[model samples]
Target chain A: MAGMRLQIIGCHSATPRLLARPSAQVLEIGNSPVLIDCGEGTQMELRRLRLKFTRIEHIFISHLHGDHFFGLPGLISTFRLLGRERPLHIYGPKGIKEAITLLLKLGESWINYPLHFHELEQGTSDTLLEAKGFTVKTFPLKHRVPTQGFLFRELPGLRKLKPEVAESHGISRAYYLKIKQGADAIAADGRTIPNAVLTEPPAATGSYAYCSDTAFDPELPGHIRGVHTLYHEATFLHTEAALAAKTGHSTALEAGKIARAAEVNRLILGHFSSRYNSLDSFRKEAQQEFLNTELAADGKVFDWAEL
Target chain B: MAGMRLQIIGCHSATPRLLARPSAQVLEIGNSPVLIDCGEGTQMELRRLRLKFTRIEHIFISHLHGDHFFGLPGLISTFRLLGRERPLHIYGPKGIKEAITLLLKLGESWINYPLHFHELEQGTSDTLLEAKGFTVKTFPLKHRVPTQGFLFRELPGLRKLKPEVAESHGISRAYYLKIKQGADAIAADGRTIPNAVLTEPPAATGSYAYCSDTAFDPELPGHIRGVHTLYHEATFLHTEAALAAKTGHSTALEAGKIARAAEVNRLILGHFSSRYNSLDSFRKEAQQEFLNTELAADGKVFDWAEL
Candidate 1:
């Protein structure tokens, strides 16, 4: 199976500081490059990381907070300045179009390229985007405002052909695809070749789930059950669980509990509040519930095959 | 005379690059700290420079271009997050309030601090702001959109009193102001004391003019005549003079001509286009016309006393 990679651009809560940044990530699944949750300085971070801005064809925003998508207008304007001709797509919550349009109108900056905005509705959980190699689904998240989590799952891979067996059977390259699709090759003399003898089984599919800026809920595990990797927000430590609940955010222990219930293979914790001086306690706290838990750091990359 | 310090936070034009940043500056005039032309990522630059964010009470925006004022909303939001209670005032072109209001409403982030917006009118030149020691005024600039330049002038200082001379003349502290206002002190017994015997003359008032994102116009020199120092945008070189005119920007030679025509003491060329890899040419070109011309670099400081 083709491996997927996730690059954590930023994963802090609230305003950007010297050490911490707001939420932003880049997920690379096969040939598709997708950007998630662009905060105030996401473009600068992306440039710092040496990521090609024009290659990011699709962007997904979790909510309407400035930390989630305030950098959209600047990024769009930059793409125009760089003379990008490809169409860019943005998937965000409602009111995003109006907000971006108002800023552009005020600056009188007309975009030279096509910009497509896909607004997600409230109280809906459905497939949001589908590409050649992967699909993105949105699930409702409980926050102070309307929020949603994204699930990226790769499609099943093509079956492998037994080259030596196919060569002995004198099968042409055009007919090999038909044989890999579980079809028996019928020869010109009306003789049939068994499909099982010509092809091998397909590889297992991989999936990743992302949940941020949301409170701990029991129903979250049901939607992302058996995910290969889950990135859940751990905004606060267990000591501040009360404050977390009041602010509609989750603690490290709470995120671990959700990951444990979901039976995911690996759990990544992110969206940490800047109040915590050290991140060692977050990993220590979450590891008590989920053994394979790790803390998310900016510019850190996670490969699906490593899990 | 009290000195003014200008901090060049960012001096590049258009989109920010790896080492170059967009337009933003911090000018320290006596006791007041003023922020000028806040572009994107300006708040981060302010933090990097270790400037006191809460101490900045006034923000002057030259125009509605994204590179000039897009950082306002983020800075305001960060101030709220940092628990600032002081009133913050913004002076900019029309539609600034509407643009900021829409973004804030979309994010549902209500500010706790008082934010006052002063919109500039087209084809008008007037005093826009007055504080304890400094005053800011606006002048028309020729850009693609409705734009303006700012003039910051320090108020005249109090006359220095000769303590022994005043004491010998039996001049009480209550009558010190009368003696300092170019007045002859009248003693209690009706003795006349010359004004020059009691106090020294006040120092000359210093002024700074900022003209950015504008084309070369002859009328500009008339408005900023005899200014102590001028920061004029030199977006292109003389080789690209035609491109500069097409884009409503000025070349280095043109900015120097304006400084020479206006009879300004010093010229600081800024808002440079990112195409020129080396900035030495900009200074070389401008210095041909105006001998005391300097390039505006990030983190470069210009002291009014030096000029």
Candidate 2:
């Protein structure tokens, strides 16, 4: 429960194939569901998975591609119709606000809740959010348009409290929080009690990186190095490497190479081109360079440290 | 084959709930499938029904409401991805081209096929298209936004040819088309055969009209009078007639009056508010004034004269 879980709602590239959705996923980190890239049919898919739409508070978009951004307007409008009161924050490339608000103006369906848009225009990585127990950072991606790869890392949690130890030291209940924060406690006799002797160590945190619609960039590995799981776009196979580069996409082998370079614990490849009949080849090919590689599909879920 | 078939892809109003889709339909007339009002899940519905998306050449949009037009950009982008070569024609309210093209430009997913937009700005009724065996016309509607109601009427076909009559008359094979066009046939001896003697009467054609998100306007029935099937929005019941009028939506009772005044063969009530638990009340209320009324639901199909 303390780890991260990435649920792939859709992972296809270019367009939405029969049942293969475009780019959209629910990354649950720190017990919060963050939406990434809302393509067409995302709302239906969210409903299909029975995930509460209201739980998605923050949305991270990778780029301005239609497959990634086409569903934003509909989802935003649906939120208003559902009488959403909580503020919705959208982080993506510039011009998202204008494009989405224009349709709202035309329909006269302005939202009742606060709608915040954080437009990213820089070509460098920046920390975007610091939430309860995790932080979200964006790194630059090489694409035809402005793109950002999101990295979610959990923060170190507080140390567990030892009630017996605290009682033996005659420590008051008010000082328990300070002891869990690694601070020494002052006992009833005004003597200092070492926190190391009282409480256990905090649980290790996990990290997951999501990079899509990007070409093979050697520098990308540096931003997501040593992540527990890295989701990289493998839009084409090794046979179409040239076309993949020309279109600012990566082949399965190239994505594997990036995973190997980053030394990530596991690799999950997605955003596959619909031209391929079966996705088995993607995993087989990526595993050549990164042994712990898995193919992403609709409704596929990956918990932390699971290949 | 000679009659029209109206397949309701989605008929609920406002947001797309559980399995209820928003406003979208496929009206097949004269053997060609014409798309009407593409909502959020229209493409998925089309795929679910195994309807060939390419067969949809002409798309009619009643208004700029999100439920009616939000899916256009995704559908257009998909057409390009699917390698659609033929041109796509879209008829809707003004500013549709600008709204849709803006997204296309942002995504850089310009369609390879020629996409022509017919934006209607005026509030006057006018014929928009005259195709193979049917003609499409738009009529003004009372709504918060600039909305248009579409009427599709079948054109007269060639008279049926009687092979036995033509053989006995000794008419030339090359003159069969002429005889079918109601021309008299001439025998080898210069004797003329009356057209009625050589050909049978042509089969009758059925017409369908689509109207949604409109208030109760007495003048609307005159525009689509005597249609075989009139699909009107019945967003609320008579109990909420005041609320319906305020929202620029028609109640079931009001829609029934319009159908009765228009003297349509059948009435299909759609666009019901999601607040209602059962749609039976809408059909029952509409049937009070127009006994031939029926309720429209997701995936509901109405054949000509089925009511």
Candidate 3:
């Protein structure tokens, strides 16, 4: 697997304000891109970021809230207008299909590409979606509605074989395959070759977990423990902790605590309330507990290599 | 009544483009400000325009399209958060109630302000809504769904009473009201006074008709005939006439033809397609038929006095 990067398209919550589009982000892994939570102006944000829409093969919608998925119909329609032929797969909660279908029925039948909808039911966690060089899973999150968080883990790479040593030992094709699979081999001439002598250790695999628009849940630590990157919602501050709980949201301190308990390498906090005039307060509050905390500003790009 | 002004808040069609918001417009008629076609980013657009949200007493939605009314829920939610106590009246097609109710149910428990819905059905054209100092009437429009246009007419002012002339004719205060009502007065002394001796003619009344998103309909001309300001959608150009018809949209030439047939003093064309890179062709196409055509740009304010 290649390096992965996350781009924050929009981080504002509730209503849009100055310089923010809405709640949307893009995860770029290798050549494929995965869009998460497209809000009203997601397409515009994608345009601003200069991202190729054709590269996005999958979209993950957290819930049916307007801020979460209002831009889906427009993005779909634009894709059709742009003459896209590739199949676009969307994984979301059950009500999303009905919401999208209702929008399509309202005289906007211009989509020419194939759109696949995978409706996720409530309380279903660790649902495997795709497995190639990497694996993707979903876990239920505590929210006002049936929302789910996504986990992405890159598959471990094959061990590298020492070509010079293998050639000197005259290793056969079957013996080379066994060596690459971390097995010791005994030759026909009674010469033994250890697996450590023929193969080097595999590269480390990295993982990213996205827990958006959810209340602070300590249980998430066990599910997303030791992830490379964690993107959590910090919609409010500690001063508004009561309001955050009442609205099924999380404060910056709560998000920091969750990141600390999960032991994630880096924490990118976003989904800020429109009431906040600036993001400085959120950064200050979250960094108090977690020094690796970073505010998820719109258009900010976070590279996994940096973590 | 004061002068009427048309404020273009969000003008991009299909999807928001080039940092412009979606399709929303503010029609400021004297002291009453009415919102037309509240799109997803309308609240932000309203804030950007520096208009007080409380001044918007009425909202007229053209259809059930997301680009037309998806911003209602967010705007309504913000209104509640702002502690607005004034009644907000919304006029739209039959499905508007269901859409708004579903959004409210998904978010807050209840709204603090009084919300009123006037669901419009077919064959209800030319129905008067308010007739205090001005008259607001609805007219049918041709579209993919059930949609209606609105016409606002400022009532004729009372005739100016010349005090010197009234005293010379011995016109009392009781007779002045009858004279202003365009009737000849008969005093208690059995003396008849001509209405011409008491008052002069009233000022010319003005009318503004908003013909939202619709295809070319000749019937609309008769309904909104001779209006001072007319807003009609120009979704496409003449080159895309076939596509416009297939999508139930109109070209700039078609919109201009309607304005020409209606004999409106000024025509404002908007709701541009995202495919077009420039609006020069729209202006040229509409100006070929209607000389007084104006392209409705975002944040542009068209004062009625300019006409």
On residues B6-32, what C-alpha lDDT tens digit does candidate 3 reach at each position?
A: 788888776666555677888776467
TM-score for each of the candidates: 0.97, 0.95, 0.88
Maximum-DockQ candidate: 1
- Residues A190-303, model 2: lDDT tens digits: 998888988998887889899998999999988999888899999999999999999999999999999999999889999999789999999999999999999898999988
* Model 2 CA lDDT for position B68: 93
State candidate 3's TM-score: 0.88
Sorted on lDDT, highest at the top, how do the candidates line up? 2, 1, 3
CAPRI tier for the interface of model 2:
medium
Query: Which scores better on lDDT, 2 or 3?
Result: 2
Comparing candidate 2 with candidate 3, which one achieves the higher DockQ?
A: 2
In candidate 3, position A184 carries an lDDT of 85
Q: Which candidate number would show the highest lDDT if scored against the true structure? A: 2
Query: In model 1, how well does chain A match by TM-score?
Result: 0.95
- lDDT at B150, model 3: 86
Best by TM-score: 1
| True C-alpha contacts between chains kept, each model in order | 0.54, 0.65, 0.26
